[model samples]
Target chain A: MRSSLILCTATRFLLPIILMFSFFILLRGHNEPGGGFIGGLVAASAFALYAISHGVTYAQQLLKVNPINLIASGLIIALSSGLFAVFNGSNFMQGYWSEFKFPVIGKIGTPLIFDIGVYFLVLGIALLIIFSLAEEEEEIQ
Target chain B: MNLIVLPVILPLLFAVIMLFAWKYISLQRILNLVGSLILLIVSVLLFTTVLSDGVQSLHLGNWKAPFGIVFAADILSSVMVLISSIIAFTTALYSFSTIDNERESFGYYPLLNTLIMGINGAFLTGDVFNLYVWFEVMLISSFVLLVLGGTRNQLEGGIKYFTLNLISSAFFLAAVGLLYGLTGTLNMADLSEKIKLAGDNGLITVISIFFLISFGIKSAVFPLYFWLPSSYHTPPSPVSAIFAGLLTKVGVYSLIRMFTLVFTVNSEFLTNIILIVAVFTMVTGVFGAASQNEIRKILSFHIISQIGYMIMGLGLYSVLGIAGAVFYLIHHIIVKTNLFFIGGLIQKLQGTYELKKLGGLYKVYPIIGLLFLIPALSLAGIPPLSGFWAKFLIVKAGLELQEILVVVISLFVSLLTLFSMTKIWNEVFWKPAPKDNPEISFKHFTLSKKIMIFSPIVFLAILTVIIGFSVEEVFQIANQSANELLNPINYINKVLGRF
Candidate 1:
């Protein structure tokens, strides 16, 4: 898109902050209103902003693993989290809680892990689509 | 974990595994075969368990029924899953020989496994919203499979297939929303009980129509079937065969499930509408097949015609009728998939699907011709074959109901179906090969490739014959499945944990 210098610099500055906010949203999802889906969208938009200002290749470099790999790993993590219940003698996707709490994170649970998996999945899929579209546009140019 | 959820989970797990093994095509094939074999074993085990234990229902996350996602497998769901696994196993085997490396490299195996997972999930889900989610999963994977090659024909077909399906999904979602608004439940069993209490409201009838339109498009019944013929023949043979075999049947299964389990059948108006739709669907589908020259297209239109027979069983809404529909569904999946596989072999040999350009198969490859005949005759309702039994039950049900006009139309449709089969037999097999046609010698194909192609066809054809000869056993299962449908008490009690 070749935006103006101010917009490009602004995007570069805001990207990390946006990604951190997305992680915050994901972490609060299990008990609060924000969840993995919305969190992932926020993160994807940050990267999308970077791709637009800098170029897709730079965005690709930042994403060391392919989006497909991210998607697969995310799904595996999510599915295995569900299987934790089976090993614990509960039904599939049954949530198990541990007493340990880390800093401000409260109780650790399988559902939270599931939510994190969803976060990565949604982020990867969104970037995959956006980046492909951006690259195709670049090729046309 | 309970075995009830294995059919859905195993395929999903394999799909993810295949994604990681994407760079290794041979390894992916090995994984696909092993996964499919394991799925078949799981499905058969589940079916046996259902047979012995009655319906099995599991609540995900240990949440109680009507609140949590429930996976319930009754005789009907178990049998459907078993047949689906069988077809998937065969399709996996056939794809080894038929699907090109380009498509394989593009994640075909993963998508296929994901599609199986979707089908299993759809078959077993007890919640309406969960069914919608599974449909989306199935549809997305199917959309990818349809256009994997990126050929012009494939993309064109993909557009029509996906767009219409998306519309159907929207209709399905809207109907789910309205039903929830009225009854305050999305669970099938709970909805069944509540809808009964709600009585024969005109709004309920409208809701039924919404469901009818939505599922009708999916099953390609009657006037809403334009997208099927245009799209089904575009994919690679194995992809098309699996689509031909499983996809529409899922729609029909949903129709049977919703109408039989959820909706009250007190309205004669609804039954009459379905009856009319069934007759017209049969007539139109067979007529469409008669006009087609391409092998897969002919088989594609025949799929629509065969669907009418299944819907007729539902329209009858009798014990025998539903049983007949169930039997027809099982028979059609095996026969239709085998026919498509044979068509693929024909295409491979002759390098064309057009009837005018294909010939001399009977002389050159008698075994292939015989393979073709089994499904062809069975599809035409010849005696001692699966199709004949399927038709007999439906026709007998019609006669018992004294639906003379529909019986006549059904009989005439069978005759017409036979006519089209003969057309294929004559043009593709009986006629002499045209001069200048390159003879496709069997010498060109490696023995393993030949085995890969032939084994699935032989296995499915043998299944059709076994089902035909052992009609009593198959019919008994269908009858029991039908009885379960006719009475949903067990299904409801199990899912709701009322027992």
Candidate 2:
């Protein structure tokens, strides 16, 4: 309950960056250890940590948006990413590839987009649950 | 292609829309309505698709073999999802004015949507570990919803509900770990295939027991019925109704699916153990309901008793039996929710759930009184009501198996159920009016509350009527659903790489 603003704001900015990092974990999860589920969970942990330090209201305000829309957008993004795979004649959630050898960025695929969708979903649902429960915790007092 | 994934995705998308629009009641209403509409259409389409295609599987990320996550949907899963979405949509409509301002935090709208996600996910997931995860998603949301208003009673009940379920989750995880260790695959389809290859081994039996312990607690079957009565009575009627309608059914659905497809039913050892549990559960639950003084408490106890009937059918392991369980489950969700919603309305009118404190509401709210009878009689297995057909099929299953005792128990329980329902009628509606009291200022039927509460009853009552007359059709669908569950290869072939 004793979370600081610097920690909070730092996380407010830092969590997304960290979540973005987890996206790589999901993208390469098929070949290695990480994948969508775990990556999504990490993103959830980011929102949760921020919510704990900031009040639930602040967390919602921090998103500067309603949590539901955030979740919806994530779902659409995830679903459409899957749809993209389907369009490419792959199965739902099938990873698609479009790689270019840039100077720095190496091979990347459509799975990265799916991970972003998952990132928002995990964060949104997790936030939805926490905020809903936290609202009750406040009421009890 | 996996029909199961659609249920999870669609409402999830809508839940977001509802959450954003939560502050604007009209917009929230529209989002909830439109979202449910889309889900309903999708469910119907999926149901038709499954009927024609047998099963549809989608491997996530198109990765082949057991490495990638998979989703499978067969007839049973699709139909169940359809029913769940329909109930959810109707309940959302029913909640419009009834959700009380204090309880109507915008977040709740999303929570409802997520709750659907959990249920749909649980129903459609093709793997064991994933099912466990889906169960958690569904359940934790129920816990929050159960105690949403944070009334003192709700808190006490919610804590117990949460703790017991958390323990159940641990048991489920333990089961999953053991099964995964033995079978090396969490996908239900793959597990079904492998479990057959394993062929009635000792490890499988142990794992089955672990699953029984876990799902048993969740389904609120015998020995685990303690938590239901204690916790269920606390929440507002709508919350209680939804909990009654959806949550426990997930447990029952899982039990039937796993036992029939994966664990192998009636292994003599398994069936006999379940049969014994069924009898005791039936007796205890009926008696428990008979003795309860509170309306929701009685219904809660009745839920236990009703689950006994469902399990008895499953234990019989006959086609008719499993089909009966499916019908009973579908019937129970709608009927029980209707009854609870009515109970909530009664509380609104009389300001109490206590049977002793109430009387003569028939004069005050005749339509509601009539409304209560429809589901009550249906619940009690009266002839010409949907409840009768549920029991009839189960009894037919018992007769086919020549299990006379189970048949007799089912009959006696039906009578007792009727008696308990009548007691509520006698006390709450038929008896002479109590002296005008402070709690119920004698003013009844606000336009908004009437619509909010009556809609659930109207819809369910219509379903009761439809299902009653359409017994043959309902039974056919239920039978096919049961058949699909018993052989989940069709499901697995669709979700994972085709075998």
Candidate 3:
């Protein structure tokens, strides 16, 4: 559980940058290769790095929300995305698009929302497993 | 709008909500109860709709068949869904009394709903790959449910259950990959027609056997049934009841569905293999049950034995045989689940599940004895009960098919089942209490707790009696479902709109 000062200092700068990049990946996932699953992994790895630099306790405090809630919310979002189509008299999981398109990300749709849900879920699951393992490691040490 | 999706989605929705409300034990309980009740109503609605309108299929995202995932509810699918919902509702009610507060607060309701959702999805989906997805959903939730308490016994059982099921899933996935590679379609209806056109018997048979092995493990047939008795007795009573009732049946349902719809080319060969497997499954299961002294363990073996009867009907490959299978399936789900629930109640009241350690229930609580007798006799295929009609149908079908050997074995198995049930009755209910033991009284339980537990058992026993008495009505439905299964054209036409 030893932490180097340089690593801790470096993590302070790296954390937000990595999170922003993960969001970027998720936002562009509809058209690009980077989607929620990969983005969530990236986000989770950034937190894992932070936990290594700081400690599991500090990293959990930084998370603010419980990982299980994040997972639950993500599932709700994903389910509702499909449900949107059903409410619109379309088939389940059918994507509906708006005419106004953003420059970086394409037109807003259910698929992107669905991807975001995946992002949260993957992030939550990854973090939960990592944190639990790290805590176990600490206990053993 | 396709109501077919409701039975699947409603549980998912309920699971998600319960997940969010995980901390509120009372709220979670009420929500689960309400959710399962609503699911029962929705399944009934779906059943009636299918009955009046014929087979129903919903293409997700409005994609055409052979391309998009479809949820189809034929008579068979609706019947299975309806029965599963009934089990879901009863289990939810049963849990109120048996499940501890720790398990409740630890996400039991959500997991249970997810399992139901998976079961419904498996029954309703028209796509093979989607069926795999549903199976995973069901398995994942079930894995957690099996090991939820994290007890030594549970973990031990969970590891074996997990390993074997993972292997089964791998086989299932491999089969799907090969089938898709061969036929270029994942839609089951599409696969039916395309497989016929593929016209290569040798490879198709190979793929079919791969599927048979995969599903055989899940359904707990013959040699593959070792995991069932080892793991099922480890879980809590309600969990074991649901597992005994619905989980293996999903595999049996898949076996019946695939063998009937998609694997007709090698009927003679497959029939021989299936009949052999069926006979062995029956004999071995009953023998295993007879040797068990524990209540749940005995019931677990009985579940395996009864599965053989269903498979036998399928091997018969006639309308009556299939009808018999369907009837046996519906009857078994009710009887097996009730038996487990009664087992749980016995454990609760007497504080032991070991036959050698328990006795005198009939002397103290004749009501309990009566309640247990209904399902016990039903499970033993006693006359004028639901199981008798079920056994009669299958035995008659076998006779008509001139499958005298299977019929004889099946009847012998029935006798063995009776012997075991009577053994339970004699040991647990009839015999006097041991010298060191005192008589346990139901007066100790609160009225509400007693009501919560007994109501489901009473309700299911009544259902068994109703189905037993109204055999004509139930058989007609089973026959109709059997006819639909026999002719895949109706399913294909409904799903693919080939007309």
Candidate 4:
């Protein structure tokens, strides 16, 4: 195996940049292109890179909670954002837009928030499917 | 703004909350049981509202149709929602007695809740693509539950199940793609109007056949049925019970909805094909049922046969035919699930769902044997029970249509159904128990398990009796749903804003 120095250096140097770009992709999703699903996939890719260099055991140890819980949480958030319309006396999954302007952030709506939830859900489910399957592959090792 | 969205929302929220409390058995159990009870109330509220007001809709985020999402509830949908959740509620109760502690710890409640979410979402969705997503969600969750044990039997069965389903999904996706290209819209109501305007054509038939192949695999109709008996038998009791109870019925429900709404214009071609499929499906399925030695496996084969009766109603494509199908669906869903649960009870009491290994249950638990007998003969379509009425409507529809061959096949199938039920009685309850076998004792059951398992079966079995006695009211409800399905302008206007 390669030395731990190479792996640690890669994760430390690359993770923040990857996360920043993921948010960039998510924020621009409504008009220009990149959306929650793609952003989530990108963020998950960063984690995959980390898990690879650091070893899955280290990644599991570093994770505060299980990936499956993240998936459930994401589903709740995504579903709730849609249902909020119902509670608000609007129709289900009817996009609720709110106008906002910020110094750093450009604009946001319930769509963006919903997108964030979808992002997290996709990321979590992807990781869960990948890592578990990987672990199973390793168990057979 | 429609009221259709709440039923989907509340359970999805519960599914998430239930996940957090999965470590605490008591908390998860409370949440799931309470969650399903909440669903039942929500469904009832929806049904009563829709019954009065007709179909209601909520456009997501106040977005207008053809632009943003729409969630809808109609009289037909709301009633089905009620039936589905009530079944889920009862099954959750059944799970308490059947699932081991390890299953509880493995996020069972959360997954089950989510599975219901997927099921409800599929039922309630107004859009076709959204239906596909929800179908995948339910199927994936179900696949996990099927393979939860990872035992040799489960793995073997899981592989078969997954392969069959993966092929189905590929076809489903292709059909969706083709339909999108043809219609340029994924909304079901919108597609209906457009399709009617365009009129029935060869391309539409191609798309419809694609869907039939996809759903037929799921429904396990005729030749697509082998995967079901082998695979459904491998899951644990709760899985088997719920799978037996609700999932395949979802396939049948969608098939009924789609054909009536989108594909029935070519009545001679499509309807005649469905009739033949129904006939073949019934004969083959009953033959399979007659041949089986295992309990749930036999019941599994019978699900295919019963789907034939439902198809008969649909294939006839009349008010009487569809109403009969709807009534039969409601009857079959409850009775079949009850029989499966009785199979579970048989397993609990006798330690097997095998006919060869079980006998003389009438001596020890005569009440259970009685409870069991009502559903068994009812399933066999004997008179004065709910099953007879369901079949009566379909057979009457056939006679009205003068489809003598189809009607004759339906009769032969019912006779075979009776033959198989008698086979079960002779093997399981009438004969003496084996001398060497140990009997299940009271010590084996906990109080919660008893309430959870027995109550729902008893309640549903009673409802079956009530439906039989109250055939007029049941027929009215079915007739109303069928009228709405046939004259979909009501559903169409409600969803697409009177265009």
Candidate 5:
């Protein structure tokens, strides 16, 4: 879908802010309502909007890495987070937290890591399917 | 971290690793082989642990029983896992020769491992909702595996398979919702106690029917089995083989577990209905096989028929009956998968699955003919084979129950099963090759490929013969498992940690 010049410019301006907000959602997911699934979906919508205003090829170039790779890596991260508990002599998926606080993201834990993994997974899979469909449409045209 | 959860965890971890290693085909194959071997070892250990220590339960995320998701391994669950791992290992070996580089590179290993994980989870899960989740996991992976080749026939079959399964899943979910509403619990052990307390209600009977229909569609019994024959013959041979071996059996297992464990109020009406369905499923399956000339399609119909025997055992609702069902289940999975592997081999040699277009295997490949005979005769309930023992127990149970008519129909179905098996034999092996392509042989294939093809079939065939010869020991275990199913007190107590 080719948008008007104003709409395209507006999408470009809104993309960064939307992406940042999605990250915020992912970070606050453990204590708040917003989580990895919703955050990833929101992030994916920003890229989808960019693809609509510009072209799929431009969006592809922006992605830098294949979506399949992102998905695989995301799953690996999530699975490893679960395994980390086993290494610590606990059950699978047992969560552990640290008191150390980062500058922006406060106390870190395995659950948060798992949420981040889910964030990448949902974003990668959604973009992968959508971009492929868009590319197919372009080919038909 | 518990031993009981390893069967589910190991395969899942392998699948994730396989996803990343998808680019390197040979490496993926090696990893799959090693991973399946590990799964086999783990499941065998689980079997031994359950044998010695009774039921093993793990509450995931460290939560207590009724509220938390529980993974429990009883004798029945462990036995199923053991058989599943064996099939997974053998199929992984067979896939090396049969699966092409194209399919292998497309994350076939990952999907296969994921499917195994799902099967293991389904067997071990103590929570009904968790069982549904595992079924979805199994279903999605199986869907991809079914349509992996992207052939037109496969896509058509995949759609049919997916649609029917989705409807069944909907039924299952609704039943779960209703059951939860009634009893306020999803744990199988807890539900067992609560359902008895809430008992004798018509609504419970309705819920039982809902579960029957849901699991019935899954197991492909009688009238609800059209999607099975239509779709099962469409996937690649190894894919179909695994589907033949394990998928419907999972449905049967769930049926057995739910009926025997949770819905313990057995009315005469329900028993009669189940008996009728069992007999019809047998007759229709065999008759359907009799009409088909294509090898896999014929075998596919037979899968439905054999499911009847298992259900008959359940309907009998006796110690011998459940044991018979358990034995039939173990024997059938190995035999059915071996038959599909042989079919794939025949297809490789003759370039067709249609019996009329293929022949002369007895003369050119006598060894292959013998291998085929083992599973074929065994499937037909010939004496001293595994099927004979399975059929004998069920028939004996029927007679003991005084259901002579059902027994008569079952015996007739056995005869028809023999007829179909003989038809495949006479056409595919005894007859002369078609005039167009006279010489049908696997002579040109490399030695490793030949070994890869033959090893799984031989190993499984040997297992069948071993089970046949060691019937006493095997039956003892089956009897014990049956006793456990008949009396769920031990299973419930262990899962709830009441002991």
Candidate 6:
């Protein structure tokens, strides 16, 4: 499959915006319908789009790390977020909100950390699938 | 710090650590070994705590029961977790020698821990949806494990296993959705109470059948068991051993839990159906085993047959019967896994799994033959072995219930199991090697590899012998679990904190 110059130029412009929007969705997920899963998907689509416009190798170079490691780190982060409650003398995954509030993100808490973990994990998984399939297609061609 | 969560969390933790340490094979191996040992220790602690404390529960996010997800462990859950950890540990040891570097580097250790996490989560979760999630975790990891080597046979078998299990999961999800719609709760204890109040026995019965089909496919009962023989023998031996030991048993575990806890209202009819399924599963499984020419295939079929006895116990529906089922479950896991381990060892030594191509194992290695005899005899329900006690309990419970037909069928199946075992022994051990069979020896393995493989088989064989010799103590544990199962009121109270 040959990449179009127009498509490549559009991806170059749209990638950062899509990634930023995914983070927005992830942050808003605490109160709204969106969460780590959707946000991660959005972020993954950004990279996926870049892979489609450019190439698998270019996308991998851009990502700079293996997606599997991303998944592993995401899992650790998510689990540690849950562990915060255990450290606080409560059951696993108990939510404990702090009194301080941030300007843009509002309240920074374990739930946000959990969502970040999910975001990384979802992004990793989606990218892994996309990259593998794309590379396989490249091979077949 | 909640003890209940450790069984699930520790595996996830170890899996992650191993994932990051993937490039270093030695590090992964050490991590896998240490993780299994740690899981074993934690499960033992969880088991002891549950035994002494009656019932332990942890409500996630501090969400009280009937609302938030809860992880609960009574005697049954704790015992299953403990036994599963033992298998995980031994399978880890077995894998050290048996699994090749290709598979190990292909994320085998992480996947194994992930599978254990899923199994433990299924055993411990108090919420139905949570159980479904755990099942998915198990299935995903198993799917990868099944096809990790990417051999043609592995891929073929993996597809069958994957498709069937996916359908089963769909059914389970449908049942969960329907139940939640009908009763507005997913917690097992809450569902029990709400199911009693809902008074919609007809729909509930329909949901129960959906569950029966779902879990039935999983446990390999009767018509649904075709997947077991086709795919189980295709994976590597350690993989097969773990799968044989734990996967179907998780289904059986879910069956016992759901039927006892939430679906008890319509059990009279359901149990009658279970009894018929159990008998057919036994006869067909043994017959399948007898017809098989290979080692793992025979053992695979026998897994189905042995699952029959556990279902039979549930069908009996008394404290003694359920206890019998529990004992059979524990006994079957140890014996079946050991048999598969021995099968692997046989392949290692003789370079063939085909009984027709193999022979003279007994003459060459008497100790290996003795090791094989212990599990083989126990599996055949010979006296002074664990399987005998397990069978005795189920048969005794059936007699008390006057279910003479199942009892007779069970005994006949036992004879057939013996026949299958002896067929293996005669071909693989007793008879001389056929002409043109390549000569092979156990010394082909390095010393540490030999110890790695043999120690786990020996450990499990010893466990079988211990359970056999100390039937009273094991039975006492099973009986206690049975009583708790029979009386879910205590469980309900403990989880909901009504007391």
Clashes of each: 0, 8, 0, 9, 0, 0
Residues forming the 10-long window of minimal summed lDDT in candidate 3 chain B: B435-444
Arranged by TM-score with the best first, the candidates are 3, 6, 1, 5, 4, 2
- Clashing residue pairs in candidate 5 are none
The most accurate candidate by DockQ is 6
Q: Which candidate leads in TM-score?
A: 3
Per-residue alpha-carbon lDDT of candidate 3 for residues B360-462, written as tens digits (9 for 90 to 100): 8888888999999999999899989999999999999999989999999999999999999999999998999876666587766788989999999999999
Question: Model 4: residues >4 Å from true position, as ranges?
Answer: A126-141
- Reference-based TM-score of each model: 0.97, 0.87, 0.98, 0.95, 0.96, 0.97
What's the true lDDT of residue B494 in model 6? 88
lDDT of 6 by residue, A1-141 (tens): 678999999999999999999999999998988989999999999999999999999999999999989999999999999999998899899887778988987878899899999999999999989999999999999
lDDT of 4 by residue, B1-499 (tens): 3446666677778878876665679888888889999888888888889888888876666656655566677766787788888888888888878877877788778778767878888888878787888889889988888888678988888888889988888888999899888878878888887776667578888999888888888878887877788788887888887888778877888888788777765667888888888898999999999999999989999999999898889889999999999898888888988899889888888788888789878888788788888898889988899999999999999999999989998999999999999999888888898776647454688786777778978987898899889999989989999999999887878777764
Residues A1-141 of candidate 3 have per-residue lDDT tens digits of: 678999999999999999999999998787778999999999999999999998999999999988888898989999889999888888888888889978867699989889989999999999999999999999999
Model 5 chain B scores worst on lDDT over the 10 consecutive residues at B264-273
Instruction: Choose 1 or 2, whichever is better by lDDT.
Output: 1
Task: Name the candidate that leads on lDDT.
Answer: 6
Candidate 5 lDDT over A7-48, as tens digits, reads: 789988999999999999998788889888899999999898
Candidate 6 runs further than 4 Å off:
A1-10
Q: Which prediction has more favorable TM-score, 1 or 2? A: 1
lDDT for each residue of candidate 2 in B241-288, tens digit (9 for 90 to 100): 888888888898899889887887326788877877888888899999
What are the chain A TM-scores for all the models, listed individually?
A: 0.94, 0.70, 0.97, 0.87, 0.93, 0.96
- Determine the iRMS, in angstroms, of model 1: 1.3
> 1 or 3, which is superior by TM-score?
3
Query: Which stretches of model 2 miss by more than 4 angstroms?
Result: A1-76, A86-90, A117-141, B436-449, B487-499
* Per-residue lDDT value at B133 in model 4: 87
